[model samples]
Target: MTEPLIELKGVSKSFGRHKVLDNVDLTIYRGEALGIIGPSGTGKSTILRVIAGLLSPDEGEIYVQGVRRDGLIEDGGQEVGIGMVFQQAALFDSLTVEENVGFLLYQNSNLPRSRIQDLVKEKLDMVGLPEVGHLYPAELSGGMRKRVSFARAIMSNPDDPTVGPEVLLYDEPTAGLDPIASTVIEDLIRYLQCLHGVCSTYAVVTHQDSTMRRTADRLIFLYEGRVQWQGTVSETYNTENPLIKQFLSGSVQGPIQVAG
Candidate 1:
């Protein structure tokens, strides 16, 4: 078997006195698209942050491709390779799309200006935003901004020999979009994975039914700080587990106790 591309061993986290995660363990295999489905405030996004080193788990070890990594990752003191798309596009207000996508290369690569420009254009084209490279974040639609974020995250190709991010983490990629638009983003996510030969794409998706059904190959249902149950998307439809059943059914009267 190909070793897991990413693994979280007995991971736990807390905010003040509120424990958000508790001894949660996970493993992701290479070249797979895995989606997390759960109700609100369940630490789904926090899992992504933990994987990205944006937030460290108070307990447990994190490994990438079967090797342990130190805090923030440095070998000979350089940044490691990972791509991310945030729920909010999180683009720099002053930078044009091309500038944002190519920002890392300009600072790191010794390649000439023309070559960098060509690379930037190619990246933009890959994300279906060839014309928007010259535009700023404010000028584009929300969907466009998300695409820009995707492009920039994968732009540097930080790892050698391979040409892009090893892992792609997305935080609620389909939020606040119409059905058609959400599907477009979902398709784009899959396309990017296949096109770049990404090792694995881990997504922290919200409680959007269509997005989950359309995108996820495997579904892990997080409830009250733990992964209560897990299975494929189709299994989610027939689950007898009350939380899973109550959630997917959109029912208020079930085993799930909603606080008053």
Candidate 2:
């Protein structure tokens, strides 16, 4: 059996008095795409943060590639090799698309500007946004921004091979897009994963049904800060689990009650 690329053991997190994640254990294996799905405020995004080293758990241990890490990762530590794409795209509005995609390399590595430009063009092309590198973020549509965000998240500094990410975490990659655009982004996500061999594992937190169905090989249902259930994507549609049923049906009346 293949060892998990990333593992969270008995993880728990809280903001002030509000507990967001509780004893959540997850394992992400190599060469697999996993989806974390649930209602809002279920800490799906928080899970990605913890994995990315952006947020540390108050309780539990995080192991990446079987090594434990401490605190926020300092400069030049690349063992974890994690990348994240925020829900809002989070592009630097002032920079051109090429600059945005190549920001890390230009700022942190010794790579010549010409080489970085070539890599940026390759990534943009991989995401099906070829020749848009000269455009600014504001000039592009929401879906384009999302694709650019993916390109940026996966971009690595060739000078420092360790800087390349081994695990990609996405927080709501398909939000705020029309159905057609959402499908485009979904397809792009799969395409980029295959193209970027550096990233061996991926986890996505999303509420889009089509995106989940199309992108995820395995599905985890998070509810009330816990991993309520997990299974293959096909099992998600056939489960008799109440929470899964309610979520699939989007019914207001069920075991899960909405906040008044």
Candidate 3:
């Protein structure tokens, strides 16, 4: 197989006395869409944070494009082009959609105001949020806000490819949406990867089965802070692995326990 575009070796993280991740190792290949699934408090989103360089691992190493990120002064994104769409649609309430989308370019690039606005409109259109550039996060619906986040994640001035994200990390892209909205977001995720020509690799953390099956070609079942099973999306439904079966079947009786 091709060498992984991003790799986490023996990664472990903790919050105070509670361990969130334990000696976890994962690899994400170029152009692959991977899904991370697990019960609550299982460190699914924590893995994304570590990979995105938002949090440092207590013990372990992270390599992006074969370069270790431990010694990097800034977030490791510069080395591997990492971008993240947060679960909460962490948009700036004070900024309009256009401003939110073009914030990075406005602050970091030499591009003129007109060019930035033009690029913002283009990205909004790409996410199917056309003509909503004037709205603010508070003015949009939940799904619209999520799409705006996606637009920001993919915003890039093609003149300088270095600014674009090659590896996109999504923390529950379909999280609180209704079934219909969730399906729209799921389809949008696939559309972005296949047709939008934005990021090259994606790793999504989601609880929705439909989101997982539709967006990920491969999946890692995270349980108790470690990967309990890894398989193709198709195999996920057919696997006899107890942990997976319990998760897929949504059975209360299995290796997985409900903490009371």
Please report the candidate that would top TM-score against the real structure: 2
**TM-score comparison, 1 vs 2, better candidate:** 2
State in Å the error of residue 72, model 2.
1.7
Clashes per candidate (backbone, < 3 Å):
0, 0, 0
User: What is candidate 3's lDDT per residue for 1-260, written digit by digit as tens?
Assistant: 56689899999999999999999999999889999999989999999999988889999998888978874325434556778999999999999999999999999899999999999998998889889999889999999999999999988877887788888899999989999999889888888888655886899999998998899999999999998889899999998899988888888999999789
Per-candidate TM equals 0.91, 0.96, 0.96
lDDT of 1 by residue, 188-225 (tens): 88787777454355564667887788777888888787
What is candidate 2's CA lDDT for residue 98?
96
> 65-175 in candidate 2: lDDT tens per residue?
787767865533547678899999999999999999999998889888999999999888888899899999999999999999999988987667688787889899999
Which ranges in model 2 have alpha carbons more than 4 Å from their true place? none
Q: How good is model 3 by TM-score?
A: 0.96
Better of 1 and 3 by lDDT: 3
Those runs of model 1 whose alpha carbons end farther than 4 Å from true positions after fitting are: 74-80, 158-163, 196-200
Report clash pairs, candidate 2. Answer: none
Cα displacement (angstroms), candidate 3, residue 19, comes to: 1.0
What are the lDDT scores of the predictions, listed in order?
0.79, 0.89, 0.90
- Model 2: how far is 224 from its true place, Å? 1.1
